[model samples]
Structure formats: structure tokens, C-alpha cells
Target: QKEVEQDPGPLSVPEGAIVSLNCTYSNSAFQYFMWYRQYSRKGPELLMYTYSSGNKEDGRFTAQVDKSSKYISLFIRDSQPSDSATYLCAMLLYGGATNKLIFGTGTLLAVQP
Candidate 1:
């Protein structure tokens, strides 16, 4: 089974809305979870990173992880037009010599003006 599962959505919302993006994992070994935002024709940029499990908030964004449930989520508050992008959820396990990020199929979001 795929380690991580995220809905590959073309989710649309109006400006100033609160958006919730989510990902679920099947692997219990994942220790590092991250959320990345990628603009069209641009590279993915890290938005939030969590070690182990906890809730992390920065500015208008918040990331939550529940290791016991193997679920992680990202919340965008006061969503703006600039926030329209593809959001990726990634996880890392430290066993391999060269650990690589396992990313979910990105979810596309559009915030209308």
C-alpha cells in the first residue's frame, strides 16, 4: 500500500476562507512530516515541518499531526489569491542511508479574489 494518501483535489475557495488540507499515512515509522506549497511552473517550497507529533502554527498557517492516527493536516487561515497552489504532504523515515521524502500526490487549491 502507498505510505501516504492524500486526495488529489482541485479544491476551490473564496478569499478569506479557512482551508483545510489533509493527508493520511499507513506507515508508523515516519517521524518527520512536512507540508509544501508549489506554484505553477515553480518548485515546491517547504511551508511547515513537524518532528514526531504535535500542532504547529505559523502566521496564518497551522500544521497538525496525530501519530497515533497516522493523520496529518494543514490549515490555511485567511486564504488569499497568492495561496492558490498545489500543496504536498511529505514524510521521512530515518532507516535508509539516503532517506528521501515520500510525497503525496499534490492537491491543487484555488482561492478566488
Candidate 2:
């Protein structure tokens, strides 16, 4: 199985709707879980990072991690057109020398005007 897997969704929703993105991983050795948002061709910007199993909330974004199930999710509230972007979930190997991250394929989100 792939280390990380996510639906490459072109999920479209109305403005002000709630958006949910998710990812699943097969490795239990991953110690860091992160969510990144990318607009078009630009590089992804870190949205949230959780070191272990727990929930982290920032602004309208909430990140949830479940190490027992090896799953992670991101929730976006009060969604807007500006929030339309590709969301990527990433994980880093534990005790690795470098900070290399393994990424999911990404999900495309579009908030209608």
C-alpha cells in the first residue's frame, strides 16, 4: 500500500459551506502530520502541523489526527472562494535525518461564489 493516500477530489461547494479533506497512511512510524494548501501552480503553504494524535485548530481550519487508525483530516469552516485550493496531507518519518515529507496526491476544492 502507498505510504499516504488521499482522494484527488475536485470537490465543489457553495460559498460559506464547510469543507472536509482527509488522508490515510499505512506507516505507523510517521511522527508528524501536516496539511498544506496550494493555489494553482504555486508551491504549497503549510496550513497546520500536529506532532502526534490530537486536534489543532487555527482560524477556520481544524486538523485532526488519529494515530491508532493512521488517519488524518482537515476541516475548513466558513468556506470562501479564496479558500479554494488544493489540499495536501503529508507525513514525516520518525527519527529521520532530513525533514523530507511524503505527500498525498491532493484534493482540489472550489468554493462557488
Candidate 3:
């Protein structure tokens, strides 16, 4: 199995719909989970970062990590067309300060008008 697995979703929804994105990893040594949002032709911007298992909330975004299950999820509440972007899930190994990131293939999300 790949170290990380995620569906490359081109998920389209109406404006204001809730969006859920998820990923699963096989590595247990990964300690940091991150979510990044990227628009066309642009590098990804960090949207969420969490160390270990738990949930973090910011504005309309929520990120959840379950180290035991090796799963991570991002929830976008009250989504908008402006929220349309490719979402990437990334992980970093423990005991690293260099911030080397291992990324999933990413899911493309589109919120229509």
C-alpha cells in the first residue's frame, strides 16, 4: 500500500454546502498533519496544522486527525465558490525540525454559484 492514500476528488457542490475531505496514511511515525489549499497556478497555502490526534478549528474550517486510525479529515462549513481549491493532506515525521512534508495527491473542490 502507498504511504498515503486519498481520492483525487473533483467534487463539485452548490454554494454553502459543507465539504469533507479525507486521507489515510500507513506510516505511524508521522507526527504532524497538515491541510493546504491551492488555487490554479499557485502554490498551496497552509490552511490547517495539527500535531497528533485531535481537532482544530479556524473560521469555517475544521481539521481532525486520528493517529490510531491513521486518518485525517478537513471539514469546510458553509462553503463558498471562493473556497474552491485543491486541498492537500500532508504529514511530517516525528523528531524533525526541517519541515519535510509528505503529501497526498490532493482533492479538487469546486463550489458553484
Candidate 4:
């Protein structure tokens, strides 16, 4: 099974709405977590990065991580049409010489006017 799993959402919402994206993992060794946003035909861009189990907010975006549950979430406030894109959740398992990065299948979000 994949270490991380996220809903491949074509999750649609109205502009100015609150949007929530989530992911779950089966691995307990993951120590680093991240969220990426990908526009159509473009590469994923790092949106949030954290190593601790807590909530981190940057402007309208908030990322929450819970190590005990192996769960992570990203929240977008005041969703915009410009925010329509694919969201990817990633985790890193760091070993002395074998750090591995795992990514989710990605959730697609669309904000409509």
C-alpha cells in the first residue's frame, strides 16, 4: 500500500469558500511533511512544509499534521478561482543515508465564481 493516501478530489467549491484537503498515511517513520500546488501542465510548487505535529498557517492557507494518527490536512480560506489546481501531499522518511520522499496521488480542486 502507498505510504500516503489522499482523495483525488475534483472537489469543487464556490469562490470565497473554505476549502479543506486531507491525507492519511500508514507509515509512522515519516518525519517531514509538505503540501504542493500544481497548475495544469505545470510542475508542483511547494506550498507548505513542516516537520512537527501541529498546525502551521501562512496567510490563507493552514496545514495541520498529526503524527499519532498519521494524518495531514491543508485548509484554504477564501478560496479563489485562481486557486484551482491539484494539491499533492508529500512526506519524507529520513534515515542516515536513505531519506525517502513519498507523495500522494493528488487532489484536484476547483473554485468557481
TM per model? Answer: 0.95, 0.95, 0.94, 0.95
Q: For residues 7-103, what per-residue lDDT tens digits would candidate 3 score against the true structure?
A: 7899999999999999999988887899999999999999989996889999999999998899999999999999999999998866657657899
Candidate 2 error regions (>4 Å): none
RMSD of each: 1.0, 1.0, 1.3, 1.0
lDDT of 3 at 43: 99
Candidate 4 segments exceeding 4 Å error: none
Model 2 steric clash pairs: none
Candidate 2 on 29-105: residue-level lDDT in tens? 88899999999989999999998788999999999999999999999999999999999999988665776799999
Better of 2 and 4 by lDDT: 4
Question: For candidate 2, what is the TM-score?
Answer: 0.95
Residue 88 deviation, candidate 2, in Å? 0.5
Instruction: Give model 4's clash tally.
Output: 0
Report the candidate with higher lDDT, 1 versus 2: 1
Candidate 3's error at 49, in angstroms? 0.4
Q: Per-residue CA lDDT of candidate 1, range 9-28, in tens? A: 98999999999999999988
Lowest lDDT 10-mer window, candidate 2?
A: 92-101
**lDDT on C-alpha atoms for all candidate structures:** 0.94, 0.93, 0.92, 0.94
